[model samples]
Target: MSSLVPPAPAPALPALLTTVLPALESLTTALGIPRTVLASDEEIEYAWKDLPRELREIPAPLRGELVARMCVAVSTGLFDSAMNYIWNAAILQLRAKIRNFGVPIVAQILQSDFEERNLVELQDSRLLELSLKLNIVNEDGFFFLDQCRDVRNNFSAAHPTIGTINDREFTTFLNRCVRYALADASSPRGVDIGAFISAVKGARFNSSQNDVWVQRLSETHDAQRQMLIIMVHGIYCDPNTSEPSRLNALDICGALNSGFTASLRSELVHKHSEYAAKGDEPRHTASLQFFERLGLLINLNESEQHAIFYRAIERLWTVHNGMNNFYSEPPFAERLLELSKQSAIPETIQDQFVQVVMCCVIGNGYGVCRAAVSSYEQLIRSFSPREVALMIGLAATPATTLSRRISSHLSCSQRFKQSLTLIDPASVPSSVRATYDYYTR
Candidate 1:
């Protein structure tokens, strides 16, 4: 939005200067944003002048709003406050001067949004500073977490282009881009800090409280409230904390129940196994990534020394919790079997496995192919021809095309046939058959 609402002009230059000087002086203090990192007003003026001729005359009203927005954005930054204030002011000035600057402005706006988002995320890292202390209140404030979830949605809406990306597409794109970042050991730690923040926000915790968490993290480090600082920062900074923070708080609360942590950990493992039993690759990949990150943090030499030992324990807990369901849910159980086979031999190359799996899931056919065939067999045994045809159509082509694409580009063997055999015919519902048939033909 805007910086200062322009002071109404007086009759003459000297008259205006005499009356307005103190207000300008007071404005600086009232806004509380300083010129510490701000460029000279002349530089901001020059930046405005250098823009396209159409953008030269930004309306006074719009300029004021833009400045206000920048002021709010700046207060959070130490070095960045002034720089961003000037930079955002420049961008907003340019934006205000246009009729249809959508395409031209998209790049700048998107970039600004990203920077702001990342900054907020960086702030969130010290969440203990931002998180509200759970005092003994009359009501459970679950709404706080709900608010955070809403903010996450807002961020997603602001960047809908990214939202359009499917899981596999995103993974592929990330792997490619992150390769350079990961390889460049000489790169600054700040880059990784930015990257790590982006990754966390992108994956978990959607809400305005999340925004609060980030804001507070950056603004305060109160000596009197050390636990608040550590708790928020620990969760936000820790690479393994994927679940929602509200849930995390609830879990921590249950720790007062003595055996709750063990019970919760067991429940977590059962949930993971359920995902595996049902052939949910997305959840599977998430589990693998979670453990892998933990494993890396823990000692690599000793089997029991992983920093993320609890995550692995949780994974195991899920397996044991659903032992009975494992038999009844044959396809689901087989998913674990498959995961166990694929992940049997852990290596130092975590990224490689992630990339390979990502490649296997995206575009035209690769990931769904195996699942489709297995579902198809299950369909044939239990459903009518029309239903089978529908499902065949739905699942078949994409799988085949994915198979062909990967086989051509990456030389990886396709597994659609194997995946098909694993599905139980009784699980193939009739409407699903129509979807299968449409694609199969």
Candidate 2:
């Protein structure tokens, strides 16, 4: 593992760093970073004297703090510390852009690759490269960051250095650091969630093509697009859609369904957790409610959420469409069953719920539901008695394969056997009754 702590600077270095740190403080002003990130307890360090004039690129808000630290590092010949400052400045920019506190947004940009290989941990260089893709840093910025990585590895405090970075090279790296990693500027105007929400709320759909927005969204970098998607999702679920913008927002959401259903499912638990912590929750509203919304917005982590989710599942369930196998898969279904165990389901639509479960039991499409038979069994226990009773009647009416599968599924349920007393021998066809008997036995 690469060590983050730099080796103690040479014994003679402290006094030099202490003296120059004070002198540099006179060069420029800086709004220092969090106290925790301070490299030394010495007096506030100064800004770069000749920090480059060009290199208008990604904005790093902590430029003053970074310059101070880097100056202290290079002045004292603490090459490693200097590199660490550059690397951290990049991280600070990413954090500022996404509002994510830990694990740089680069990790998310490369989520699929990292997850596939189980590379849960990443190094600074790889993260910097991935940042290019995220637009956290541009392609040109990536080249300078790559050089910074090399210099930091070879000359910075993190690892042993056989070579030295002299004043000229150190200054060049500092300029690159300032330009690429710590440009002190605001983000370029793109998608402002607040402004866009205001527009949506006002129903500003004057553009002939709503698809134009989605197309623009598709063309943007993934990180920015994802940010917009998340913002729109929040809007789509907002409780105060009493304005015209709500319709405009819904139109945008309908247009931007690019694999977002699956993404939304993945985020349900976290989003609910967010809503739970907030003071204002929209419990009574249907469309705008956050944590308590039914349907695709359900949070499986909260047992209370399942009742709403399953209720929506029933409302949306048709022979043509159903829950898209998110819960039918094993551990997820187990989680669903556990959450909904004591859930109060309406008796009127109970069989509809049972029918969906039966669809899984039958594995009509893929064997997705087959992976968690136990979860489905527990779910069936809620309305299976009524459904099995109906299936008993359906079984007697026809000898068709679909009816037989229904009969077979009913016979497969252990609860069905114990509830057999609910059915009369006269109620079902003689042949179907014998078939049920054979399966039960």
* Top model number, TM-score: 2
lDDT of 1: 0.33
Q: Write the residue-wise lDDT of candidate 1 on 1-441 in tens digits.
A: 879976444212122234433444466667897643343333333322332221223334433554444333222221123222333343232222221222222223234433333323433212212122211111122233233223333322222322232223222322221221111112110112332234344544445545544443333222212333223334433445556642433332222223223433344445545656788766545544433432221212233222133333334334323444223333432332233332322333222222222223332222233442332233234333343334244333455433355455432323323333333555556756454333323
Candidate 2 stretches greater than 4 Å from native: 1-147, 150-189, 192-195, 204-209, 261-268, 276-306, 309-352, 355-390, 393-441
Per-residue lDDT of 1-441 in model 2, one digit per residue for the tens?
Answer: 897975323222234445665544443335444432333333221222233232223333354586567656655445457767766776556545433321333344444433323222456676676567567678888888788878777777667776655545665776777677566444432344445556666656866646666665655554566667666656655775654555565567656553455555455445655665674466223333333323333334434444565655544333224555535356555544643553444455454555555554445423334466666666655544445555554434455333555456544344435434444555545535665675457
How does model 2 score by TM-score?
Answer: 0.35
TM-score result, candidate 1: 0.19
Model 2 accuracy (lDDT, Cα): 0.52
Per-prediction CA RMSD (Å)? 23.5, 17.6
